[model samples]
Target: MTPSVQSVETEDEYIHVRFRDPDEFDTIRTPDWAAHAAQDVSEGSEVRTGKQKDSDDWEVQSVLIKKQVGEDKARDEAKQIVEKIES
Candidate 1:
């Protein structure tokens, strides 16, 4: 399934690319699509997936370290990571 990008924002020194996955429960048992994408990603990119303590939905976030590869590159790589999440 193709995940959708719910929003994008910058926090601290990282550009956060956020996506959502429906959770029937509070459990997040989906594949670590972000991690797998990170392996082939660049610019010190990283991803996190979890169900927030106060929310019943699961969120997938890809962060691009702005200090590492610059904002432009980081943004490109960040989106790429999200694209390659399951492709």
Candidate 2:
């Protein structure tokens, strides 16, 4: 996992994760994951997931998180995204 850390935010069905590197930064989206998790989510809810810092790149981190969805469902979706990224 990367040492890089970021803040996460969700808007509608979209997720926005921001990583800070000063010179460079990255953001990841999981609309498909959100779609699946959305089924159990209300119109406005906060969903929190987990994030792992990269071992190699200190300025990089991999986060599998979702917001605006049910905890159980959002976790499931986050797991799916993690699996896909790992694959």
**Residue pairs clashing, model 1:** none
TM-score of 1: 0.51
Error of 2 at 55 (Å): 5.3
The TM-scores of all predictions, comma-separated, are: 0.51, 0.30
Give the alpha carbon lDDT tens digit for every residue of 23-72 in model 2. 34233233444434433433332222333243232222233344555445
lDDT (C-alpha) at residue 87 in model 2: 41
Write candidate 1's Cα lDDT for 1-87 as tens digits. 546666566777777665653342354443555565675877455676566667765555435445546556666676677667545
